[model samples]
Target: MEYVSVPTDIPDEQTPLLEVYDQIGPKSTFTQTTVNSLNLLMGMGLLSLPFAFYKLGWVLGLSLLVFFCMLACYTAYLIGKCMEFETGVGKLSSFYDIAYMAYGAPGKYFMVVLFSLELLAAAVAMLILFADSLISLVPVLTPFKPQIMIGSILLLTPLTWQKSMSKISWVSFVGVLSLIVLTVAILWDGITSPVGPGSIFDPQQTNMWPEDINQIGLGIGLLFVGLDGDQILNLGHAVFPSLYLDMIEKKRFGKSVSITYTIVAMFYSLIGACGYLMFGNEIQPEVSQNLPLVPSFNVLLNQSALSFIAINPLTKYALIVHPVNSTIEGLFNIYSDTLTILSRTFLSFLVLLIAIIFPSFYKVMGFIGAALSFMTVVIMPTACYIRLSWDSVSWWSRFAHSCIIVFGFGFMTFGTYGVMTV
Candidate 1:
């Protein structure tokens, strides 16, 4: 049996030892479906939900859904063009590769730097959310949160080290299952709960704030983080870049892209819409906390039961709580508090892992109104233009392009600091 390996560092000459490119291509039979499901599930996770819910409510959520539909439609069109080109000789694994192939070595380098920054920013945002969640869950844990986060990273690093891509994929698949189940349960409960006479479409009744225009704008800016093009771009390598091409050759590109994008858009929009209708301004930790007040889900039930067992006998009996005699929790807590220690360790690791891995915000979005904003915005379009029109490209066009990509780094240096402080 052949085995494939995904390098810790991308763009290296080391081909996977397996039949598939562990890093770039679908390795296991489970890769495609599992990864796709995870994509939607992660998109709808606790971290992303509440803010969207608070800002849009059900009405705007639907509007956002429509926007996603449009986005998918447009993306599918690009993918179709890519397929028509039959440009599958080279790897389209990362934005940089796509840019490099479409443009030149310079374009490739530009994309790498740009994407790396974006990933870093994303990582930071996740850390911020993780730290915030820890503080909310256990106030006393606040003082040690940062330490725990860092420590957890050290611990997890070894476990994740030398692990195969398939392993990572499967583990992520399992984690996503838990997250999705929790989210769906929460949303279902929220939808069933009673609501006032006002329509979910009504902004005023939905607790939306048209009064805070700046806030709305900020919310839109933040949405860009979630609507990131990286995920789609990543699909280029994992799936056939020629997937659209193959379909097109078979006269199926149009239908395939259309159906796929529509499905993805509708799914996310539905999740977001449901969550928004249920939780409004009070929504903060979008993915995790915004569920309905009813505590029926396992995680919620477990927490409630634990709380009840501590406070009152009637509530404990209602939950049918039984004290552990020699369980893991008991053994650990009997002599030392395992949950607290483990929680601290786990939360700390996630915070640091996210901070380091995801790119900075400015790197992802680039400066608004900048001429080179096009660089960060459209990978394929810019690459295609550069490739086909390199020599005949206008002097101004070249100048503008250079400015757009260059100024982004300068902006990131300053913008990152600003973001951290703010």
Candidate 2:
């Protein structure tokens, strides 16, 4: 259960920016850190929010989005506290570090297992998105989505071999550009053509409230999946500690994080509202699928947007699976080219199979948010905070943390069931 630290052969110039910043003393200003967080994590869940709005309707959907954002923000603060608890063994680097500090080896195992699952789930969701985009772009690429998913995996495998994080940093730009183009295209169409076959602005096309109150549980899960795009700031529990530790002033994490979450929530709410108004009950899981791909400016935007989606995940497959690969290599005390290739191949194929099976971006994301994220974002933070700061943590804070844990379980349970059933 001991966390491994496997050194790579990447040259000094290729070291990760965060590591370099840590070595040189954190120079990241609050604005810079917040912007970095926004750039890296904002869009993972953004595309799905419109359909999330469809599920819970406008009111409840937006409420859950904001609420989940708040939860992610506060838990992030909890993570900072966990790091502050101090094990007298220098700085803690990841969720595994915090877990091991609070509860020993068992905790480290839990973190590794859960984090690995979450990463694969995230990668799977991305694969589904990338494949779906290909099908959307080229209707004749063997209309079967599974085939596209496999083809995309095989094509991206070579790029995934690059061990240096710098080689893939450009992936961030792909995500941000794609988000801007998609958002602009969606909002532009929503404003310019508010009434037409592809345009919608009627009560029948949208609702302030969901027709079934019972869906509120399922709605929470779905919206959490989408809102998680920002609230976790896409760092996930595994990577967040490093970002937090790299801050110029760790004390300022709350402020920078709060501002980042607010920006993400507002943008998500706006796009969710606009997409619903445009496509109403017909919005696809990715939202881009509903864009008016007519012969116009929008079509050009669609091409750019789809191209980005297709390429974005291809870049991430290696990054997400790297941690898992490292953990296994470090745990076994063996590292070689053969091991790296086999591990990456096994992980990629595993996720590809999962994507081919579930296939629905919405459902897969919902399960991730409901099951994995609820645990990492909600349960783990509070648990770690209480364990690490039980004495110094305020009495009210302790009670609040406990209450949030119970609530998280309900959300995870019901939310997961809802995804499976709905």
Candidate 3:
């Protein structure tokens, strides 16, 4: 295991590690990488943004969205910088790889466990979304929610067996477009519909601050789940190194990351604000559910939203679970195609089982965001940066890193309690 070892000598910009990364093959162009990052950043999580906004009140919600977006970008930047450290022959490519490089065997084990759990939790949430959407769209499936979930697992199991991302990239693109359409529909509906007296966007409604302390805490947890891309398993902070390595123009990798997050943040703000303004406190966990269901134009929007919700998860389910499957194969040294299929099938079934047992989408999201996202997006990167740069960096840099770590832990603690109690 080649870890990014600590250097006795100060590493300048022209270090051998930097030179090695420069020599590596660039498999993706800047545009391709940016699109991929955007896709990963915006997923089913967008569906929960409205509820998060309503919980926190409009002003606080928007502020938190911007804050978290900047935090996510900064943490990713730190991961990129840390990956430039000496890791023997090759560069540290994944979140687990960086963890191992930074903290050896213990860190590797911890990251593997966290990453696997996060992936599994995400898969479970997707299945829950699938079953809920199906039941909502097709009334006949209402009583058969359990069966629908089981069927979804069976349908997605084969797709997971396909080992290449390129095969599913088109479907991923369609999924992204579906979300965009959903966002447009939500915005359109919110603007056209009559605002109720208690609507958050209404002038008569209470301004700015949330009156309920409990709701604010819970909202923070839910907002973290909605806005934080780190909960997406394979493509969070872990993805920076791979993106950096794949870029045709290595120098522009940082700029690309910033652009990707900025675009994603804008989308989140739009959806969250629109959805919350439309429904206020009555907002559902999934924004699609909040849309009016009638026999007119609203019906068309409702069906479109539900259809996309149902289809999008199925399309991205395989890719979402890919990291865990690959990790298992690597751990057990299983190279056989047949075994790989079996492993994916079993894992998919397990995730479906969990979904069936705990079908609360927002709750699951809050739990995952608090437990896993906080560590991956905040704590891990800060810890690694401090470990690698402690002796060489300034006191102010160390103090800033320490504050981030503390903030991560504090938020995680508050989020966990909020989710559990709410």
TM-score per prediction, in order, is 0.57, 0.87, 0.85
Off by over 4 Å in 3: 1-36, 161-169, 194-207, 230-233, 248-252, 294-297, 333-342
Badly placed stretches (over 4 Å) of model 2 are 1-23, 197-204, 212-218, 227-234, 292-297
Q: Candidate 1 residues 216-312, lDDT tens each?
A: 4333333333333322112222133334222213244555545555665555665555555545554443444433233433456324322321222
Position 307, candidate 3: lDDT:
88
lDDT for every model? Answer: 0.40, 0.73, 0.76
- Please report how far candidate 3 places residue 405 from its true position, in Å: 0.5
For model 2, state the Cα shift of residue 399 in Å: 1.7
lDDT of 2 by residue, 109-193 (tens): 9978887677778888888888777877886764688888888789867665556667776565666777787887776666666
Q: Give the Cα-based TM-score of candidate 3 against the true structure.
A: 0.85
Clashes of 2: 1
Instruction: Give the Å error, residue 182, model 3.
Output: 0.5
Local error of candidate 3 at residue 3 (angstroms):
30
87-133, model 3: which lDDT tens digit per residue? 66556666677788789989989988787888888888888888888
